[model samples]
Target chain A: MNWKPDKNKPICPQLCEHMSVLIASGEYNPHDKLPSVRDMAISAGVNPNTVQRAYETLEQQGLIYTMRGSGRFVAEDVSVSKQSVKTLRFEKTEEYFSQMEALGFSKDDTKNYVKEW
Target chain B: MSELLRCEKLTKCYGTKTALDEIDLCLESGKIIGLLGPNGSGKTTLIKLINGLLTPTSGSITVCSEKPGPKSRVNVAYLPDNSYLNNWMTVKKIVDYFKDFYEDFREDLAYEMFERLGITPETRLKSLSKGNKEKVCLILVMSRNAKLYVLDEPIAGVDPAARDYVISTIINNYNPDATVLISTHLISDIEQVLDEVVFINNGHIVLQKTVDQIREENGKSVDDLFREVFRW
Candidate 1:
């Protein structure tokens, strides 16, 4: 963790996005244990309350599940992680295509460049 | 989730100078709040009133639902802006002094931090570098398991490395059920760690809002909003 969060955006959402990317990319494998709120807070240099909020939202989203006495873990099923990856991929492609279009390159040109590379 | 501190029409005056106007505030446990303001603001006055170092000119202040006195002092750990450590005392002696004085003091935690910092217990406070001395003070304050931790400018006048150490020490040592109120004007350095921020100006509270709320509503970080709010 190199946690370089964007200061312009709210940190909780950024944390959620970061964790989601990690889970979807297999960096955090399915059923891997999530770090405790205090540990995550120290690593991220944010408040524990903020980390707790992110974890609660993550639990609600079904990306992570919490056991009564243990701790939070990534979902056991891989489909949820795969679905998130698909959404992220589409988002990244859309952003890149829009950027290329603004620079006077058509979507076809962008596709050709990728194919050429 | 209980209320840890409250101020009701709290006012403080020095001679004819009004240092703090009547201000009402409440703080709940388990929060890390930032008391942000420029110099000459009522931050110090409010902190003093909370600690019972100075009596309020009028109104009332409470900690754990009781007035600031012997009973409340036991639950509040205060790190004043100025250094209060006597230079003659060795680190070990000071540790003993604190452990004997405060019932909640944790000597083991204090020694652990000292060892991690490579500070020998036998070293005198006068021989330590300025940054190391500040760290010692902070470690002592944080070693106590108090309900409310009031730190006034804990990061001020230290090197960046020491600043990081201070911040991390705070995040690591604080009890999860307690609330911490840190007062500082250097917003950007500690903004990420703050749950809520209270902006005070000229002895009156200007605004109070959660850090995320500020970012989401104002479309800017708390540091940027602080600059905008306190800009001359």
Candidate 2:
């Protein structure tokens, strides 16, 4: 994924969301090791602390697990992660709809517009 | 979180001219912080005091619980606002000097950076251009694996490519337990990498907040907020 830290959006949440998507798509299969915090931070052009916060968020959701000092890895159970991916996709869709509505787009019109994707 | 550095009512005066007023600040470990303000806004004064170049007129400042002096200098890697290397010295000699003075200096990293910047070890400091001189200074400062890395306007007066190189070098280095205090007016260039920001104006701290908190509260970038806070 071509992801660079965007100053406009809060970096931690954006990274967390991106990692979740990758996990859900099986790009990072179950039991795969995630990039270390420092590696992710450098590649993303952000502070390691921000990356750490993002990793912690993923860990809390059970999408990733830590083996003490070894490193963080994708969770073994795929079903739980798939469910979270569904919820996250739904949340994003809702956000897009709400934004369209605020911009004067009707629900039916927004549905038709999304169909173009 | 452990307190890596702290200042209490820190005041610095230059022959009755108060450069830094009564300022109280604290920096915790494991974060990248920006010290930002306009020119003559006490940004450099604060950094200098922290580096123990200029002693405080009143109050006190400490690094790792030790007062700022030779003792604290051990843990602090400071980059001054100018080309401090002797013009007659070769770049290789300067690297050796850094290795001698700073126990944490990494020769391999210095060589790697110099290679990327096309800075030959035998090149004299006086022979290099202003931009190359700045790059050398940045390389020397970052080569040290110090606990407190204090950089002053590291990206200023340099080209965009050089700025990107310096910022990336800083972001990749430094241990998680270390704290980086960067003093610069170029907010937009460095905002994405900053975990926290301290805004100073006329020798006083106007604000200190995490980048995420500031964005959540103001719905704008730190650069916009800085302009708003310090607008004429």
Candidate 3:
């Protein structure tokens, strides 16, 4: 998918994209505490408000947790982490399979392609 | 006991520009304080100063009787207007981090939130769509058991459906004894839950009153008053 940055797009979208990559790549583990808002804003080169929006977005998704005084962190659940990764990969696989089918690739051909890989 | 938050002649400047002009305010616990203002009115600047994210040019701000610092931060849960998560961490990793850092964090609540939102821990922050990311952030902030919760713009950019969820989460999750200060230009959506509303114009607080008092005196909703006070 083409993920070009649009100036009109809010900062939350961009920040979320960065976070998604981190989570998918396993750079941050489950139940790991995140840095402060000020620190993240400075590092991301965005306004604190924008960073705050992203954190809120993340919270709504249940991917991270925030503590009153300490700061935001990754949720603590291995099963959740596995399930999230599985869902993501499954969705992508479904998309690819659907696209291949649309291009007239038969099931046999698809199976052969998978085997070749 | 002293007020939960006390700001006495607090001033903040950005070079030659004065963002907050000697503002004095007191916030008590168990109340939802709405910080309302127009664009460039320094509402955000004042919030930053109180949270210790920005130093005031003059005057002082006290949270629970101590100056705003690491000590004050422990009791304050701040939600800025943007995302603060590192793009590299997985949802599970973020949760693990919170458990380690916050002594009062409840793992069960976090899990319940995940179930409610259908968010899986294995998902990478980058994989989820824009709306889902914001939801993740909201769940995290609301899970904390803080004494003061500062939400800069809890519902700004998202579909209408998601806005309802965000607002509901905030109302349902907030601790009744904690102080919640929400700053936003979108007043109508949040006015119903706010116990008190404070209006700022040109970096100065123009009005501060209880929701009931405002309605009784002005015979208008907080949004209407905001429009009248901030009419350009």
Candidate 4:
């Protein structure tokens, strides 16, 4: 995947978000094996330590898990992926609403615009 | 055992000029640390002292818990800023030389990188372009499974494409048990791969923090912070 993590923000959170998006989108299926930390770091052009931190965050969130000696894998539960999708949708919708408010558009106007679209 | 390198009040001077002032630094293993600063800021002086090329005027510097002598030197692989190889030596001969000089050198790994770079072993150093020569040096250094890898400006003086190649080579060859110390002035290009950064100025360290800490505390990338810290 083409990873463009923001330079001004902490890299771990960004990596976590990107990987979560991948899982929610089914690009990384529920049982798919995740790339090794070194491989991920090389692909994203990031430090291995940062990638390790991101993986730990994902594991804690139940989006991924480690199997001893076999490396990390996406959680096998389909509900986990669905939950990620719901959370992502809410985050993006909230972000859109905030931006609209900043631009002087009311919440009702945003809902109307989305409904009309 | 985790402390790969440490400098206790290390000082270096040349005649009447002090190149490196009293400096104390500690580096742990499994890290890619950026030794960042402006030119003539004593980065090279500190690297030389660590490599045992120059004796410190005062204080002590240790690599792998031993002074910078033969014992420590064996475990440290240094890639200087400029070319230090003989021009007439072919890539093949250079590989042989490195294998003989460094016990930890991996000839197979070096040749593997050469094949990927499309560089032939028959090609002499003088015939290759500057960027390719630098790449060869990096390959040789990385091929060594040393405890500490000291790279001096590995990304500088190369085209953008070559810069990417250099960074990828570093990432691919990284040993989690060893610490890699890279000295560079171009912070933005190499910021993503650094676990921590050491900001040096006027022969003294001004800041030492993890990349995440810098971003979280300052709300800016290491590159932006470097600009602000070293701005005239």
Q: Candidate 2, clashing residue pairs?
A: none
True contacts kept of each: 0.78, 0.60, 0.00, 0.80
Q: lDDT by residue for model 3 over A1-117, one digit each (tens)?
A: 233333323345556766765665677788777766656654554434445767888777777889888888887643444566677678778888888999999877887999999
- Report the C-alpha lDDT of model 4 over B2-36, residue by residue, as the tens digit: 99998989999999998889999999999999999
The candidate with the higher TM-score, 1 or 2, is 1
Poorest 10 consecutive residues by lDDT, candidate 4 chain B: B168-177
Best candidate, lDDT-wise? 4
| Runs of candidate 4 exceeding 4 Å displacement | A78-85, A100-117
User: Of 1 and 4, which scores higher on lDDT?
Assistant: 4
Residue A82 of model 3 has an lDDT of 55
* DockQ score for candidate 1: 0.78
Writing each residue's lDDT as its tens digit, candidate 3 over B1-232 gives 2378888998998899998999999998766688999989988898887788898899989987788898888777788888888788998998888878776666788778887878788888888787888888778877888788888888889787787677666655645468788889887776655668899999898989876567667766778888888888
Per residue, candidate 4 scores C-alpha lDDT tens digits across A1-117 of: 598887888889888888888888889997799999989998999989889999998898888999999999999764665777788789889999999999999999999999999
TM-score of chain A of each: 0.85, 0.76, 0.61, 0.81
TM per model?
0.93, 0.90, 0.65, 0.94
Please provide, for model 2 over B1-232, each residue's C-alpha lDDT reduced to its tens digit, 9 standing for 90 to 100. 6798899999988997989899999999888999999999999889888888888999989988899888889899998878887999999999999999889999999989999878889988999999999989988988898889999889989999888788788888857788889999999988978999999999999999999888878888899999999999
Which scores higher on TM-score, 2 or 3? 2
Which 10-residue window in model 3 chain B sums to the lowest lDDT? B167-176
Q: Please give the RMSD of candidate 3 to the true structure.
A: 18.8
